[model samples]
Target: MLIEGFIDTVRPSRNYSEDSVGRESVHPDQLDQLVRQLRIQRNDDARCEVKACTSDLGSAVWDSVSAFANTSGGMLLLGLDQESGFAPAPGFNLDRVRDQFVDGIGDGGSPGRLVKPPSYAIERGEVDGAPVLLVEVAENDLGSKPCYVRAKGVQGGSFKRVDDKDIKLSASEIFEMQVALTSQDTDRRPVSEAEIDDLDDALVEALLDRRKGSKALRGAKGRAEQLSRLNVTTKDGIVRLAGLLVVGRYPQQFLPRLLIDVTVHPANEKSAPGEPVRFIDREQCEGPLAEAIDQAVSVTARNLRTYSTVEGTARVDHLEIPREVLREAIANAAVHREYHQLFQGQPVTVDVYPNRVVVTNPGGLWGGKTLESLDDGISRCRNQTLMQLLQSVPVADTAGVTVEGQGGGIKMMIHEMEAHALDRPRFRISPDQVVVELRRHGAEIPALRAWLGGLSTDPLSDYDDAALLVAKREGKVGVTDLRDLLRLDSDDIRQLLSDLSNRGLLRFIGGESYELWSDEPRLRTSDEQVIAALSAESPLDIHELSAAVGKSPNTLRPILRRLIGDGHVTPTAPATSRSRKYLRTR
Candidate 1:
């Protein structure tokens, strides 16, 4: 389902009736609550928009509406003004403006015309008792896309929300949208520029040998037959882009952007988070997908750390980031990248850094995927033919180990990282790119220690200090977990985490329940026997709190009383209370 449908599913069933205003009465929804949640902040992105009525509201406001519909559908707040940090529009006349908007989005239209086939959900709500118009636009059916403004035709009026800006559709982009609507799989598109002879014979032979070993395809016969069976190429000898990319001598020679660019950068201590970056080792892989993934991995491994640690008997070598992760990232990018839209100068880029590696592929999450949905390990291939071709290249030693096997890639990547004692990889989406940032915790100790060393001396800053100190002691920190230790609310925890991340003290791991604060917990207590287990910020129930500290509540009573009497601790309840929980006195 599209994002709009997903949002709609969460909205409770509402029976509509005509209000005096003649508009369909939308039953109670979180729209009012949503207004309250986002009233004070200004973050207008692809998923959100804050529109204050202008004199020519129909033209300007409708453009954003069309942009939202053509791309991912988003919430449209009409009475929210950016000048006052998205506060309710000043001197806003709710009834007149709502009527104007209702008429503007009308289908049998003319007076206040906008949106060709009006497919927007408008709700009247209030923010701080000031009426706010919340309009939610649904993404158009892929076939009838380029949801345009009434004045300007589809070619001129179509707009897509890219990051913060609503970019007008170029001629090529409009064409691509049409193609995307018509075609379910882009990889099957034939490469008219290339011939049958363009594909490398050796790679095809190797693939055939691999396929012959697989139980599913053991009976598969000739090269052409195998390619046809796998849907890699057309039966009429028209080489598909997928077939060419998988085994062609040079895919980029025909398809210029069908390649991966690998860059390894030297560790720069002075490079700020937001700055023009520089690279040391640069290599471009334009060969067949089989060789390109291998080449990219080999080049990246040069800069990656391979340190040794002592086990019980001897030393064991450990590469900071495992090779399987690199293969999975690169292979996935090549197999599933958007091919309908021409790659505008940006090839798939793999940036190798000291503490982390960022692999960026051009194209947002494909087929209506959000980050949470992608984490569910569901596979949606943007390029099915290419994926089929990739699955043919079997590992030499492993009898039936093919490169492009279906599913489990994400699970494998996660499991590999965890088994290596590293933080899980994070995935982020943008209008033009999909970024995967994988970090190595063992390599981040030096940076954590440096940040800890530069701790501010002032006494008033101890709260921040205590947070970081605990992070330095615990590998990761969650806000709710710190409620007792810091006596802070949700807002305070959010602000503290933001501050630490800004100051480069903590790296943020993904969060939903509460923001998890991440850092290296290498700095041990003076005894140094083991890493310190983190204490709760908010006092948990007795059993949970005791388990966190690895001691029974009865055993901790004396320690709790002593600390409370000494003014270092306080009990939320009476001393004899069964529900007693302790908080650090800060």
Candidate 2:
């Protein structure tokens, strides 16, 4: 009674306005800026389109709407002349164009309705004192994509944006959009052709022993019952794809493409003079998922350069790329890649390069995960059963440890790289594939070393070498570019660039961009060097030619074969001749 006027809680006040309505307005200033940009470019771009709507709302507007909605959102500028340097259309009737656009989008009886629902905003603005309409199309939700033109129908009308043009979606592309709408169950489906005998008995036994404590398998009567409980096999004794992949004698025999294709490329094939045209080493890792992971890791490791150091008379061999990091990447690919029929044709690829190792798997980040959110302890697997099976399967060489269990592989990778003073791994996720790149730190290649040598003698910062390398690779880099690559703040990026500039390593071009200022001599490509050596000295045997080009005979063999095939060079002897010699076909 004494505190009758006191309120313990307060409700937030709500404000509703035209701007806060179902569709918000794109600000006039922003629209103005977009128009200015369109004028400067004199053409439409990926995110902005201009149309002259002085007469009527053209049907082409809906095509842009469908394309923009399917892809990332984009803007439409009506009453702008795209053909006339993006100038405002003369005699633009804002009222007439706005009415036509509204009726075309909203009126069910009208001929220009969108086939599906998508978020959008509409506003009116003036460009160069000429009336115009700004319509911003929002990207549709993932589950409800492929928005199309109603008149042409979904299949005939749906389009995707490529560069500045809207291209029609193929049937396969439409199928992929629908596939992403549902949770994946492809791994759990029974392989009707595969029987219980197809599975490897020893692997199955070990997996059961590893999963002995799992409540799901507790009190199971026999191996059949346990496998059924684990979703590894059907009641009829038919093995599931997951079962075959995890424990089959050789999964690739049944599923040919379910394997890893590993390749070791030459260091700077484009720039390293006399580098071979073919791979240094390549292997197809085929077997059960567990065995394939092991094989992939081993094949990649053997191809990498090793640095040996003596510590108290004991030599420690360190791989250019850490072994643990490599294994983790392969394991993740095997456990997480999509097993759907759409992607079964695409095998996992592990490409080892001079300065980095790239591992790619079909299927992008699933369960609504983003690159920024990967290390936030949120793990989502497309193949839950496959992941569980891998978690129960122990590594062949390591004792008392599963391939992967805690979903902490990314964290472990980060820690391992940091401990070794290496750059953290980078990820690239697309709609159909996910790629992980592990770059070697302080493993300076010849091109990078040459560029750094031209700089001042002063010691550079920790990330200076990496940043300069990026600049050299990309031609020019700005603060934002360095920020994304180095994960540094804007202020820190400015400081780094300024320091590099003071050291005469980089020069400020306009607009926060810096061009690398090095006068190092440009080196000829490997192919060029080989061609030049052959021109100078004709009819050289493989070993002599290898000496002249400074490339190993094993590496030079492929280049010579390629040149002969290309009709650039001719061999003096038969295919099996040990004394074969090569000369230019001049």
Candidate 3:
């Protein structure tokens, strides 16, 4: 067999030269030299024998490979044998040896003999006229790990490489190896019966509706059918992790610590004196995943405040917080939480403040991911089953949301907040928890209040506040011009402008598409001077005065009538048009 061929390649040499074995060339001379050097030291680190042509030595070869892989990885020479006398060693047959080795490695029935990384390559060379196969083993950085070797009539033993020889690993090494293999699966045991029936029907229905477009969900006719289609059932017809989280009647019954705690504290409490920091409100929401999310959002919305905007002559209340965005963030926390990572009594928490809302889950991010890569579409879900179930729920639309997986909840939340000129949510990951904070409408910076104080006194609407900040820094802006600057929709821009205009804080320049705004004091004085200048230049008509003063015709008519009634201006007929005009009654 090829094992014999690989063994034959191990020829004894005259000197114990390590440099000769380390050479890059796989030439016949170099292989011979390497083989000779290995024979001198009995293959002590300088070289090792690999039997690629024999089935009898399979276990031995695997043990040797495992030793090298667990310690410092190295090369094993196959298709060669140890030289007995050293009288110009003879070459071994190479035919069929490579195929035999490949078949043995690929055998599925073999226990504790899985390929490493699977993409590693092997090569063949020659030594002492004998065919030599080189099996390069790369070290596993997963620690000084111990790997198992399969034996015929007995259970496999843990092996490691130590002091240039393959030896049985110690008890401590074996224990560590067992721990590494079982840590991830230890927390994923089957769910209990008490929690099985706790699945929420509403959440299950929502999940089924979302799965209507999925190819995997095509066979399911209803909610119960879809649950089975998603493999969310155990052998006893009990719900699994997916069902327990999405539809369970009492989700906290299974996961007692799954509920989120939301607390609102006074703003000054962060650095308050001896007085105890008072909480505005505190609520604990429980139930199926969807219900908990709904409760959390409703509570948050009830506590939030909406600012009124003066649109034209009327004031309208616009939603200060984006309900859809807040809901998505809460859902993401519920779905991505590490249910198995909790220890004794701690649970997930969501803290709502006047300026920001923080959603924190128990457990750090999975899969070596970093904050920079959070928005890069790379995700490692700790609760994949939970994620899959949540993805099937239609609580919110995540289209254009860039978070990984079909559940773009995080991405959607960020996008919505940004679209409204709010700061992007801040994410923090600790060894025990992951927290995401979403800023409110005007809480982008602490200096926002100071900045507003520097601006005019007219109560600035949210959009107007954003526009004034942009205009102050950018210099001179129009209605259409401030839209891009403030990241507001066209309607929002129009409403903001109308609000400013009604407060006598801003005025338009004639009937131009682009209108300029001046401070209220400056504009009021300008209006008075413009009327006087027009009256002195000529007996101007009301239309001429309205056009020159940049006021709406209807608005100008009321103002002109008031001025005529007050004896500040008099009515007259212009020569060009038969219509009445206004002249200063100085």
Give per-model TM-scores.
0.63, 0.67, 0.46
Model 1 misplacement above 4 A: 1-56, 70-94, 107-146, 160-165, 169-182, 213-233, 266-277, 310-314, 344-346, 396-404, 442-586
Query: Quick one: ranking by lDDT, best first?
Result: 2, 1, 3
lDDT string for model 3 (65-168, tens) is 66666655556666654445222223333434444434444532333353342112355575554555576655554433444554421124555665556777
In candidate 1, what are the lDDT values of residues 1-586, reduced to their tens digit? 1224326633321122226232543334455445444543346667677777743254677778788878777766677787776777776776666667666766224544544443665566666667766666666765556677878877778888876678888765566555543435567878888887898887788777766666645566666766776666788778887888787889888877767888777673324566676667789987887678778877887778775444446666556788889888887776666776456356888888777888888765556555777657677776766776777665434554335455678777876665444667888765446888888654564564345455532221435544665565565766765554555687887787777676666666658122224343322232121112323377655576567767777865565655556555657898678887766555
The clash numbers for all candidates, in the given order, read: 8, 1, 29
After superposition, the stretches of candidate 2 with alpha carbons farther than 4 Å from their true spots are 1-33, 90-92, 107-112, 151-156, 169-176, 179-181, 267-278, 308-314, 400-405, 442-586
The TM-score, computed over Cα atoms with residue i paired to residue i, of candidate 1 is: 0.63
Please give the RMSD of candidate 3 to the true structure.
21.5
Q: How would you encode candidate 2's per-residue C-alpha lDDT over 1-586 as one tens digit per residue?
A: 1011111111111121234322434455665666666667667877777789878888888889889888876777788888887788887887677667666665424544786645665666677777677666777877777788888887888887777798887755666566664688889888878888888998999889888888988898988999999888977778999989998987877789999999888764322556456687889999888888899999999877675434455666667667889999988887888788877888999988877899999876666666777777667887888878877777786664435556678887876665344678899865567899988643553444455655655554436765676677788878987776666789999999998888778887779988887564222277667777885355888888888988998998877777777777788899799888888778
lDDT of 3 at 268: 24
Report model 2's TM-score to 2 decimal places: 0.67
lDDT of 1: 0.65
How does model 3 fare in lDDT?
0.57
The count of residue-pair clashes in candidate 3 stands at 29
